[model samples]
Target chain A: MFRHNTLRYAVLVLLASAALFQAFTAEYFGLEILTEILILAMLVLALDIVAGFGGMVSLCHGALMGVGAYAYALLSTTAGIAPPVAMVGAVALTGAIAWAIGAICSRSHGIYFIMATLAFGQMAYSYVFEAPIFGGDDGLGGIARLDLSFVGIDLNDSRSFALFCLVVLGAIYGVSVLILRSGLGRSLTGVMHNEQRMRALGLTVWRVKADVFGLSGMIAGLAGVLAAQHIMYISPGLLSWTVSGEALVVVILGGLGTLVGPLVGAAAFVVLKHELSAVTTYWHLVVGVILIAVVMSRANGIFGWIEARWGDRIERRLSDTTRKPEAKEVLGDA
Target chain B: MLETRNLDKSFGAVHVTRNVSLKLERGERRIILGPNGAGKTTLFNQLVGELTPDSGSVHLAGEDVTALPVAKRARRGLSRSYQKNTLFDGLTVEENLGLATAVHTGNATQLWSDSLAKPEVREIVNEVAEQVNLMPYIHAKVSEISYGVRRQLEVGVALATRPLVLLMDEPTSGVGPEMSKGFHDLLNNLPRDLTMLIIEHDMDLAFDVADTITVLNYGEVVFDGLPEAARGSKLLKDIYLGNWEDA
Candidate 1:
């Protein structure tokens, strides 16, 4: 009775393509929203790794993404590097920053961790907002799209750029799934549960925290580069603590531990913000009310509610088959 | 093959662990018994690197590990269980054991390898689960299991590390008598290659499982001898059993 849902996979593929089809044909406004969703979804996925799974609720991931965007801008424009190389450089730089922050913050638990990350994020905001080399308050502009004319793909075309963003999102999703099912993911889960016990089990707690944070930062940096390419602009606003706060909200409002919730949360967030802002400038008031309602009624977020209703049964069936209960049966028989 | 020399730790004006020196030979089962505030747990903390001693050294298998961190000491074949449950609440029994084994084998950070898909890891996890009689609940979440089963998984987690010296702080503290018996049988059936250093409050369970016994009173060792000698000591009766032993 528990067969793999091939039809479900097909439906998912069809739905994904339908969204892409809409992006390709929709007006400039719709295409821009789709691009923004892809970029922000990547950020939320990055946040999910540390805050959702590792139980380290970071408030500086937005600043980390800013680091990536700024690095890309500076490296490509100033150092005369190619776009791809600049992006990689930005990710590496952000990874280093995240490592330093993680080493300090991972020492603290609960509220202390949150406060430490918030402090670091504010520090990033202050630097970017004041530093003249980064365009200070005015921010940077004229970020060019990747030159893929050699491959006959004109990235300046909106349709091609949208497709590019979609492919990147798909790749990130696949990678995230692999990571969540691996030993590293298990260790992070253990760390989240009990760091002391993980230490006793011969796993260094700080190192694990640092590595995960670095990985999260790298992924966030990837989003940063994409955002830069999409808007052709980078600003201190990108690095503000408010951006980090929003990402944290998205992760929480989506589902804290579910990998797919953040993606859904990103979509809901962008759509809500876009639609609500049109109605009134007090759009934030409505968002606040919705967040409160979600927290009070469904603490697990929208995806969590869905999981409770249907995802759990499907998950249980799949896991039951994947992990044979032979030993359990042997014990029962005994 | 474990030794602690002149381990001293103080908190401001209060001395928690005082100049404590202890030794355990290969394969010896030594239980440290004390009153509630005798600082037995503090002493264990020093041995496992959870709390560093202000002075003195911890030598495990002839290596000086006094300056080593908890995970490094564990990687060098020193492992322990906490006094509290400390099991990963969201993970399953098999997952808890598998995590221990994965870290022990230096595979905790293999991002691409599916741990559950690996047959050898699964086999070892099952084997450890069987040893602790936790096979039945291997697929159940830790939060959904009984406290007794959680206790077994705690030991199972430690054992999965394949430690040469196992340090347990009150392994059967909150478990019922029926469950304690099962814990005792599991401990008794542990391979002779494993040396155990246990901190236990249950005198009967401690005496039954331990080949040697050490008694601590107010941050100091009052007795270190065979189980028979410990049982016959008047000081032990005074501190732990009280005058009611005569009844």
Candidate 2:
């Protein structure tokens, strides 16, 4: 358990240093890719909490993010609200929408859940695509970054913005790690594993599901706000099913339940798509092939594979005593 | 502490549980016995709020709970183990017990706090695991444990919920004879404050543990009395072991 903690911290430190180095040296195109990766990683992290850990396997996450993006876009650009206020509005709107959706879909499981969320994604996509207030197919533009002059931060500079986004991503990851160790997290796992047994044990399964969904939606909304601020643009494409599908792919590619896996997945996905598209217009074909190869090689995703190779070696040695802290780690309590 | 009034449940033309009424006093060990498809498990389900009776009311500790959902009924001091092993197969035994205890203590909805770090919850979970003699396998995943150990864990899970009335559906169904004796020992050692309503196929086992017995045949309660009197019941003999005269 100590080994696992040390290793996790080590990896986090390394990632942070790398992020800092990239922010300092990267050109405009490189910084754009870096910022996009951080934003997408947050999105995938939200999905991982619901689909990977909670076993909801939601397909409407992109729509939830779009809810946030649209909220920010309209409030900041049209209503002339402060960017921070718009961000909060975006997160609030996404949370409410996600809770409503979860209330309707939480009772259904397996394929039915997938279909219901997929339908929701399609609904949001169509609504945004045709809604005149949202600029329809053309989308909203000229969105500015949050006024952080009080904090002495200028987000207009790409490097500063990328660093800020990275910090936000780290904060989200920290909160996620804390949640995965909480009582509610265990209850969510219980619901995912055996909902009936959870109910028998006096857990309100639907409420757990809805609460988890709302939390995930809030994070996704944060990602959306950051994405809008980073790009200064918004479109119906932000709400499209393809974005959800890509996030799912990242979750699967990184590792389902392991919290760090999605970050790796987001990085791999963004870099691969950017580089492959430069080589050929048929970038999706290459992406699909690479995904198939990675998934086939490492069934548990890259992080699970790493754990099996290295983490388990240290873990096996610690299992002899069944000490409290170590045992909790074995259960992935944190 | 539990009473059912004319509970009736049916699917299309087949009535699984019909006019089934029974009572269990606090601290008593009551067993319901029946032949195949005689609604023994179905009765247990209705009592625990797993199945809504077509027309009946359920009372737990003098509170009417027929309209409550399963979790609410559980919150009202009801807990149950399934006929099949419905464990969180991927999680460790400690985690399973922790989750049950967390829910029982109303700590299940805690999102920001680290539950495992809570000394009280951990102490309760460890106590339950120790009670069930599952301390050795606490770190083992449910799927990695032996069948008998899994059975113990199932009971441990129900016990961890701090139930006032526990519904056990065929607790000894899959265990071998030796393990069955261990189960008997475990039940014998349980806290006297806990009430148990059990469904068992083994007559000897049922009679051994039960303070009182109820017999069901074709979804109707044909007999309810002391275990000694139940053994002498001609109706029970005819329905369970076939013909009393032939025996």
Candidate 3:
């Protein structure tokens, strides 16, 4: 287990260093893309908590992030609240909304659950699109980044803001790792594996689902806050079902349950979208084909492929125990 | 410690569990014997709160738990093993046991630390692993284990919950005679104070482990008495062995 964790953290450290390098040396557009990747990575990480572990494929996560963005935008712009304070309020509001959604959706499973969340996402999108208070279809803007000049940091600068986003993303990633290794994570795994057994063993399965959903929402909301600040805009588009679909695609493209893989996925997705769009108007088609290829080539996604190929080799070197016999036994069973 | 009153269930026109009423005292080990489609598992489901009775009440430790959900009833010290293997196939055996022990000990809510690191949970996991004869396979994934070992794990998971009343559905359903014999020993070695209601097709195991036996046929209790009395019942022989003398 220690060896496994060491390999995971080693990869994380390498990614963090690369991100830090980009934050320090990248141009304005490059920093913008890096920040975008970080924000979406956070959102995907949150989605993994429910879809990957809790076994609930939510289609309303993009809407949940939009709710956070709007909450922050409105609280700061209309209510005249501080940006940091607004962020807290936004996350809390999103978490509560997500908890309610989870409680209701937990009653259904599989396709029904997906349809239910899609309905909620549509409702949120429609409300944001038509509501006059949210500037109608025009969207809300002029949102300012958190003022941290007092601490010898200037978030208004693109470099510092990108670095700040990276730090927050890193912290959230750390928390996600901690959560996946905790007792609650074990319960979620149990729930995911066999809901009947979990209930038989006395676990309140719905409660575990709802709790993880709420926590996931809070993380997604944090991502929303960063997105709004990064782009200085909030629109109904952010809450659209397509955004949810894209996030889900990125999740699968990276690897569903492997936390670090989502980060890699988010980067791959953003880069592909940007690079492909520049080449052709049929960028969506190209992206679709690529995703299909990825899924077909590796059902467990890119990270899973990597883990399958080299993860054991690294672990074998790190640990003294010979797992060859057991591995062979597993293969025979399969 | 577990009792059911007038439990009735029907799927469409077929009555699965007829007005089945039973009473088991604390520390009582009762064996439920039945043939195919006899509603043994249906009765176990109602008792565990998985299936609500069409019209009846279930009492656990003197409280009416008919309205309680499955998990809530389980939290109140009621647990059961599935007739089929219902294990976490992707997790190691120790994780399965650790999860059950954590839930039982109210440590499932811990979100910051490893549950198996807790001395109390580890102690119970080790103890239950020993009890179920699963010590050797504790580190093995459930998917990679042998069928007989998986059967043992089914009971091991139930025992890990430290249940006040355990309802096991066909614990030895698919095992060979040799493994079944070992299973019989395992059940015999369990704590005398732990109440168990086991559904069994193995007559020898039923007669061996049961202090009392309740025979079910066509969803109704045909006889409820001592194992010796149940063994001698002509009605049970007719329903189960089917008039072997005439044959």
Q: Report chain B TM per candidate.
A: 0.95, 0.95, 0.96
DockQ of candidate 1 against the true complex: 0.54
Candidate 1 residue pairs in backbone clash: none
After superposition, candidate 1 runs with Cα above 4 Å error? A1-18, A313-334, B11-15, B116-120, B243-247
> Using Cα atoms with residue i matched to residue i, what is each candidate's TM-score against the true structure?
0.91, 0.93, 0.95
Binned by DockQ into CAPRI classes (incorrect, acceptable, medium, high), candidate 3 is medium
Q: Global lDDT of each model?
A: 0.85, 0.86, 0.89
Model 3: residue A181 alpha-carbon error in angstroms: 1.9
Model 3 stretches with alpha carbons more than 4 Å out: A1-7, A320-334, B243-247
**Can you write out model 1's per-residue Cα lDDT over B24-113, one digit (the tens) per residue?**
999999999988888999998999898999999999999999999999999999999889988888777888888899897777888788
Q: Which is the leading candidate under TM-score?
A: 3
Model 2 clashing residue pairs (backbone) = none
Q: Model 2, range B64-181, lDDT digits (tens) per residue?
A: 9999989999988999987888898988888889889998887888988766667888999999988888887788888778888888889899989899999998988888898898
Candidate 3, residues B65-143, lDDT tens digits: the string is 9999999999999999988999999888899899999999887868789787899999999999999998877778887
Please tell me how candidate 1 rates in CAPRI terms: medium
Task: Estimate, for each residue in A186-240, the C-alpha lDDT of model 1 and write its tens digit.
Answer: 8888898888899988998888898889888888988998898898999999998
Count clashes in each candidate, considering only residues at least 3 apart in sequence or on different chains.
Answer: 0, 0, 0
DockQ of 3: 0.59
